[model samples]
Target: MLSLGAGVQSTALLLLAAEGVLPRLDGAIFSDTGWEPEQVYVHLERLEKEVATPAGIPVYRVSAGNIHTDALDPAHRFASMPLFVKNGDGSVGMIRRQCTDEYKLKPIKRQVRTLLGYPAGRLPRGLFAEQWVGISCDEFTRAKDSGIGYALNRHPLLELGWSRTDCLRFLARRGWQSTPKSACVGCPFHSNAQWRQMRDHQPTEWAAAVAFDHAIRSGAARGNATGSPLLGQAYLHRSCVPLDQAPVDTVTAHEWRERQGSLLDLLDPEDGPRGCSPWTCRSDDHDAESAVAA
Candidate 1:
């Protein structure tokens, strides 16, 4: 099965499999965080209706819970996101991230087990699934073992000597030119350009992101319910400020250089080029700090 993120690389992988370039896959599994950009869901629908269905490859959508709602529910034990925190001493840090494990990986794993014909929490010995990931050649470091014995990770993109640029070019030739990076709308790893695009083009999603940023300022709602509030304030923007007031419109020198790459090399400065995958999260690069301790 392919771990379909519906992003450029993963989409390319799915198409390649459908075209018989790669080994046929049983299906593609999408682990929804429920806070992804609107485009991601639209693209997934198109991929299913326009490609996967015609090719007889099933696409599965599974979710543990709504991340946006869980974070704000006072009675819920909200799994912390890697939110940027500003301490009293003016130092910046991040809350440890557990969202990927809870919202992405766990649900996908459960589905995998179900597909393998085994009951939850009780997989017998000598059972495994070949899980395909979409890590390209340029980002080979992101390729990792599946950690669990039931699933073995595979990277068809790297085996094909493809890179992010190659994926973009392939998709563009097929008339899929506007593929957006798949990620949660309120992901703190968003670069200035991404945030600006959301604010300018996707106003509704931008408003929701801003509202979520404000809601998490005092940390997870559960922290308040448990009578152990966060030590510092949380912010979705790395500037440690409210999302609506963030410097999204400003382009930094690093971002400028990144954009200067050939038209296909549209790499995000803060989160690198690739979007978040269930197994390989973009936040891996951003070291987590216990700044928002309860």
Candidate 2:
């Protein structure tokens, strides 16, 4: 099973498999969060028609639910994704992230089991599925185990000695260079540059992100850490301001002063260049203590 994230590296991996440069795959799975940018869906459609079809491979799409609706529903208060939040003391802290687990990995796993002919909630002992992830040599640190005994993680890109740059080159060579990063529109892991790109090039998505940011401002009524009634606000932008009004247009020295000693300060000037999938939020790099990605 290949985790088809619809991003550069994953797309390159699928293309390579289609070209018969790698072993045939059972199938590819794309776990939709239902909030990804429109371009991602467009790219998926292109791949389904041009690549997956001629390759004789099937691409299965699965979703647990609409994360946007799940997070905002008054009846069920799911924890907001680990977005950047400004504190009353002028500090910033990130909320704990559970979105990837709930929205990505679980659904893909469930679908993989069903594809394997396992009955719901019943798995034979020692069932190990070789799961291929698209992480390349550039993000080798992000390579990780499946963490469950039922699946084994595999990295074909790493074995091929491909870096992210190589993946881009491959796409360019194939005249399919427009593949966009795969991420939820409202992901707090976005850097100022990423936010600006959305606001400038993708206005509708930018509006949705801003709305989602405002929606999560008051902590969820049910699943927050306090486990009590809400008491604070949340902001998706590192500046702790509304996404539309945030200073994503420019990063000033004064803004740097305030962000000093904060998690955002330690991040690379931009977010990781790839989209995130289950088991790899990439937002964990918000912590200064977290391992750096190459």
Judged by lDDT, which candidate is best?
1
Model 2: weakest 10-residue lDDT segment is: 285-294
lDDT per residue as tens, model 2, 36-127: 88999999999989999888889999998888888777677474588666567866677878888888999888887888778477678988
Q: Name the regions of candidate 1 deviating beyond 4 angstroms.
A: 266-272, 284-294
**Overall local distance difference test of candidate 2:** 0.76
Q: Which ten residues in a row have the lowest lDDT in candidate 1?
A: 285-294
The alpha-carbon lDDT assigned to residue 145 of candidate 2 equals 95
- Runs in model 2 with CA error above 4 Å? 77-79, 221-227, 251-272, 288-294
Clashing pairs in 2: none
What TM-score, computed on C-alpha atoms, does each candidate reach? 0.92, 0.86
In each prediction, how many residue pairs overlap at the backbone (N, C-alpha, C within less than 3 A)?
A: 0, 0
lDDT of 1 by residue, 1-294 (tens): 999999988999999989988888899999999999888898999999988999899999999889999999999988899998999999988898899999999988989999999847778888999999999987798899989999999998998899888988899888776777888999887767778888888999999999999999989999998998999999998888788988777765545655676755643222233588888887653433112121
